[model samples]
Target: MSDLILLRHRQIPDLNQLDVYRQHGGFEAFQKAVTTMNPYAVTDEVKDSGLRGRGGAGFPTGLKWTFIDTENWPHYVVANADESEPGTFKDREIMEGNPFQFLEGVALAAYAIEAAEAYVYLRGEFWQIADQLDRQISELEAAGLLGDKLFDTDYSLRIYTHLGAGAYICGEETALLESMEGKLGQPRLRPPFPPSYGLYGKPTVVNNVETLTNVPLIITRGADWYNSIGTEKSTGPKIFSLSGRVNKPGNYELPLGTTFRELIFEHGGGIPDGRQVKAIMAAGASSSLIIANDEALDTPMDYESVPNVGAQLGSASIIVIDDSVSIDWVLRKTLHFFSHESCGKCTPCREGTFWMKHIIDRVHQGEAAWSDVELLNEVALQIKGKCLCALGEFAIEAVTSGIQRFEPDFRAKVSESSDEDELLVESEKA
Candidate 1:
């Protein structure tokens, strides 16, 4: 798998310095866009590149820019750095290791969109990264690379850094807009999708950290070169954040169609202690559990190929599960996380997640009846296709799949202990 955007900075020791980044062609894209090409041409180049949003939605980057409501004035570009998905930490590495490249990406996007002011909405936990980024922005400003006529052109861009109080809801494009505006960070209604009506009710381009990092390269190398790396419909290299049950669990930037075997066995040093691969939560806990099989192990990791095996290639977060892991216990942990994080904006998600947690916890501790397993599955199904956000909808992916694919594990947990058995007997008598 050939590296594209991710590996360009892999060898750079200190990405925090302005001089080091400039030495590696940091602001070349911004300079090219502002000096040689028109804003429309830059947008066209992105559209031609087939770049899609890396923040799980997979919306085409070019089309998103075209949707900007030109009738609205003073457009904005927001780099969403609030990456709080379970088992997802790819963005952190990008911001921490190659800070300037990411900032350059943000600047180029702002130039393409003609956004005079850009915002890097970071997660509260990432204040250190934000501080470093802020200093970089200031350095760029002093160098006349940013603010009030960038690179000696009329095209000027100023960037601001905003921090969130650690809410998963804020990761949503609309919710991030709300948080930026100092609101409660609840998701707004879509179809007025951010391009037309976004932050400050003006046209806004909100992209993830990794997604924006590719822009400078796309601008420098052209779209055709960008499309050549990955599989059809999902082009370019991806940073696979492999975790759990693996020897080498870290971010690996491989071409999109790289096999699961290579990622886990070759790159990740195989499963821990020679344990057999039982299942995989591709794209973190947000994806449905994929029962590990020969077909699955060889499946190409891409947007198009992953779905054939029953899951979306969301964020490329491959969480490995082994024989030592219990499917029931996995559900217990995920359900508890979702239940606590439920924003309470909608009743189905708020009530449904709490209900699922109580039932799964009881089952995990061997304090529930056999009938409870059936009831819990039903509750999970009810929550599906009926939520305000993907968080609520995907909370039950592991539980629902575990009950169907790994039934024996859940059933075994149904047998109660002496104390639970005595209570069950009393309830039966009553």
Candidate 2:
């Protein structure tokens, strides 16, 4: 609604092409930053804009840029294009449609960090998108937009595209760096964060695709201009990948603070088949189920407000669930995904997700007692805060939240199983 910063290709034709992108004020920010502004100034502008990471964590983007270790030589930049989150397809669409802008954003970030090279680490499933981006990166280099000595200035940069082995854990910044370094895709220990030691053991700045994509716009327009679009805390427009029971399921770009009612009904055309909206997974499969009450629906979909509704606006991939579906079924599917995607890095995530999947399978099959449900909840709670990465924590979000918020679904499942068991016992006695 706010003039489509990331999805400009939705309005303009051929925006992915280098010439077409350049014609529409692309690379101007990179040019300005390289030719005139200092690297720190570009970072300061982004810091002032109040832009947070769109990659679930919602960490401050500009603040992250400032953390680059100045003492470390040959710093690096990596744009996380690993869009593996279930129900979140915004980054893939961004790469396929408005790629140059994303690349430009990557360039801006590289410049801000004074890095000579950058990598766009995409999921292996995004091969076609990676191919397109590869061509586009070549085009930028050919046009003197990328490569050494950019814009006739001393600043030099080169960006490359690396494909992950379809591992979701690689979406984690340190793991992504590890994967790029040709290691097993699992998360590294913290304290030496990516900013301090990353990518072959040097200081690095790793950003999400959507997060890096905002950098160009922030640099092009002043920080104040970009800051005015969204809420004070969650600035700029976010692309919500509305899916599931919605009548019209696709990406809807709107200001960060827009309410769920507005996105689902106003932009997403509401639920399908005249069914009542039952719940909202505000952050895709990794989200805690937000009960679709008036207060939850009216709640603003920002980093700060969404949590109050028992969910985080993690990736803002709003998966609507109508009354026609059961929350237990949703939980099963989400658990399966997380379990399969788990890299087996930590015992909690690896075994926890695996057992949770099996327990949810029994629950969904109507073969579990109420205690089984409680065990499921206990296992999920056990997984919290014990893993090396967010994957383990994310695995339990739907499990704990669904059991707590949608108790009826699980109760009906266990109740039906109990009734069947009693019938079997009576028949055996007879």
Best by TM-score: 2
* Per-prediction TM-score: 0.95, 0.96
Candidate 2: clashing pairs of residues: none
**Residue 282, candidate 2: how far off, in angstroms?**
0.5
* Model 2 lDDT per residue over 206-232, tens place: 999999888898898899999998899
Candidate 2, run of 10 with poorest lDDT: 421-430
Q: Give the least accurate 10-residue stretch of model 1, judged by summed lDDT.
A: 421-430
What is the C-alpha lDDT profile of model 1 across 1-430, one tens digit per residue?
4334665657766656788888888888888899999999989998988888888877888889998888998899999999988888999999888877788889888888889999999999999988888888899999878889766689888999999998887998888999999999888877788888998999999999998888888999999999988887888878899998999999999888999999999999998787999999888878788989989999999888988888888888899999998998999888988898777887788999998898887788877777778878998888888876777877888778788888888868886444655644643454
Off by over 4 Å in 1: 1-4, 416-430
Instruction: Please identify model 2 stretches exceeding 4 Å from their true place.
Output: 416-430
Report model 2's TM-score to 2 decimal places.
0.96
Give the Cα lDDT of each candidate.
Answer: 0.86, 0.90
Tell me the lDDT of model 1 at 424.
Answer: 49
